[model samples]
Target: MKRKCPKVKSLLLRLLLFRQTRPVFTEEEKTEFTRLYDRIIQDGGIAPYDSSYPKFRFLQYLSVTKPLLFHGSNYQGIEEFEPRRQTLFDGTYTDAVFSSADGIWPLFYAVLDRSGLTGNIRNGCIVSRRGERFYFFSLSVESEDRYPWTEGMIYVLPRDSFRQASEGKLYFDEWVSEKPVKPLFRLKVSPEDFVFLSRTTWHRSTEPLFKTYLLYKWRSKFGKRK
Candidate 1:
C-alpha cells in the first residue's frame, strides 16, 4: 500500500480523490464528499424498529415544541462548535455552525453510525412536502449479526449566535452562524427515543464501500448536465 504511482498512472487512473467535492460540514459529520446528507442520515447506520410502541413521543417533543436550536452527533462531550463551510444547497450557504429549529431533524444525525457494519444500513428521516413526518430503519444481514444497536447524542446549543439560513418559503427551518459557539447542554439519546427513524423514506444501499463512492461521483457528474 506504500507504493507510489507514476504521474502517468496516477493521471490515467481516476483515483477521484480531487474530483470529490468538499463541503464544510460540522466536525463530527462523517460523509464522503460525493454522498448525499439525506442519504447519509438514513443510510448511515443499522437500527431496529419498535413494533411494540405506537408513537415516538420524545422525538415529537423535540421536533414540535422544543425551544432553542439543536445539533446531534454520534460523539459526546463537544463543548464547542466551530464554523465550517457547509454547502448543503438547503440555502445555508456560508462558513458557519449549523443546526435546526426542529430537534427531530438533528436526531437523524445523532442516531446513526457505521461502527461495525460491513455494508450500509437501511434508514432515513423526512418531513413530507405535505407536512407529514416519517422515519425508518433496518440492518443488512451482515450488520444484524455483528452489532445490536445504534448510539447517538443530542446537543442543545444557545441560539444567541444563530440566524435563519433558509427562506420560510420552503419551510426548511434551518439555522446557521459564522462564529464558533458552545453547547449549553448535551444528552445521550436512546435508540428507542429515536423511534422517529421509522418515519420518512428510508435510503439503503448494500453495495461495497468503494462501489458506493464511485457511484456517488458518477451521479454527481451526470446529474449536473444542463
Candidate 2:
C-alpha cells in the first residue's frame, strides 16, 4: 500500500497558525489540579467529555504521560492521556489487537478569524474493543480564511487504519462511526485563540479570523514535520 504523506502545509497551518498558547499554571495553582485529579479518580472515572446525553461510552483510564511544558520555563501547560486498549476480529480482516500510541504532547489554542464556517460535533472521540488493544477515532473541524481555504474536518485513526484510508482500501465514511454528529456545545473561541487537550482528542481549526500558532517539542518518531 502507498503510505500517505502527511499533509505538511495543512498540519503546519493548524499547529503554527491557529493554535493559541495556554497560560501556564503556577505551582500554587497546581494544588487545585492535584485535588481535581484525585477527585476524578475517586469518583470511579472522569466522565467523557460530554455526559449529559452520552452516545458513546468513554471512561477515563489512568494518565500515563505528563504535561508538555513551555520552552525554558517550569510552567506546565498541555496534558497527555493513556487509554485502555482492546482487541477485535473483523472476520474479513485478520484478527489483531488495535492500539494507538499516544502521539507527542501538543499545545492547543484557536484563532477567531471569522472568515469561514465554525461548528462543533459531539462524540468526537470513538473507541472500539479489538483484543488487548483498542482502536481510536478522533475528529475536529477547522475554519479558515481565504488564502489556502482553511476549513475542514480532521479524522485521526489508528496507524494501520490511517494507512488503509489513505490507500483507498477503506473509505473514510465507512471507517468513522460517530454518534451525535455535531457537538452538543460550541466552544466559543476567537479566530485568534483556541484550547485543546493533547492526549485523547484530535482537533483542527478553520476560518482564519486570526493567525494561529502551536509550540511543541519534536518527537524522533514523527520527525520535524512542523
Candidate 3:
C-alpha cells in the first residue's frame, strides 16, 4: 500500500473534525438561491454568505498558518491570509487553473454544494488585456488608515473602463486610479462571506482592519466568461 503524505493526512483529519454550523439548503431555499445567483452574475459578482454565516470557527482555524507575501513594491502595505501550502495565492498576476483536490477544497466545495449550482471555481490569474479572468485571495492592510477595526471596501471599474485598460488606452499604475469615473459598483464585506466578480470587473480594496478570507470566481457555464 502507498503511504499518504503528512500534509494529506493532516488535511483528512481536519476535514473529519470540521463540521458545518448550519443545515444544508432546502429545496425552497435552493430556488431562492438560484434567483440570487442569477442577479450576482448579472451584476458581475455575488456574496454567497452574509455576516450570519456560521463557518467562521473553521475558517479562523484554517487561517492560523503564516501567510504568503507579495514582494512587489505595489503590494507593500498589505498583509495576506493565504497559507504557505496553498500555491494559488503567490501574489503574482499569472493566469492558471486549480483543482478542488486539497483539504481547503472542501471549504469552497461546501459553499458550491450548498448552493446546489454548478460552475467552475476559477482561481487567481492574470487580468487579461481582453478581460478574460477572475481571481481569489484574502488580504488585510497594515497601514495607518486602519486605526480601528473596519472592513475594507472594493471599488469596481465599469466594463468600458476595463475594455480601455485591455485595449491599452488606460493604465492602472496603482490598484486604482483617482481619475474620476463612475464606479461600476462598490462592495464592503466581512470574512464570513465570499464574493465572486467577473472578468470585466476591475476592483481594489480599501484598508482592511483585520484578517479576512476571500473565495471567488464561480464561473457558471450558463453565465459569462472568456
Top candidate by lDDT: 1
lDDT of 2 by residue, 49-109 (tens): 2222111111111112222111010112212212223222222432322222221111111
**Candidate 1 local lDDT, 59-178, one digit each (tens):** 233334334577878887677889887764343357888787554556666776667655444332333233433323334445444434467777766677788765421234467888
Best by TM-score: 1
lDDT (Cα) of model 2: 0.23
Clashes of each: 11, 44, 0
Give me candidate 2's TM-score against the actual structure.
0.23
User: What does each candidate score in C-alpha RMSD?
Assistant: 16.5, 15.8, 18.5
lDDT of 3 by residue, 103-131 (tens): 12223322222122222222232222232
Rank all candidate structures by their TM-score, best first, as comma-separated numbers: 1, 3, 2
Q: Give the range of the ten consecutive residues with the poorest summed lDDT in model 2.
A: 54-63
Each model's lDDT comes to 0.49, 0.23, 0.27
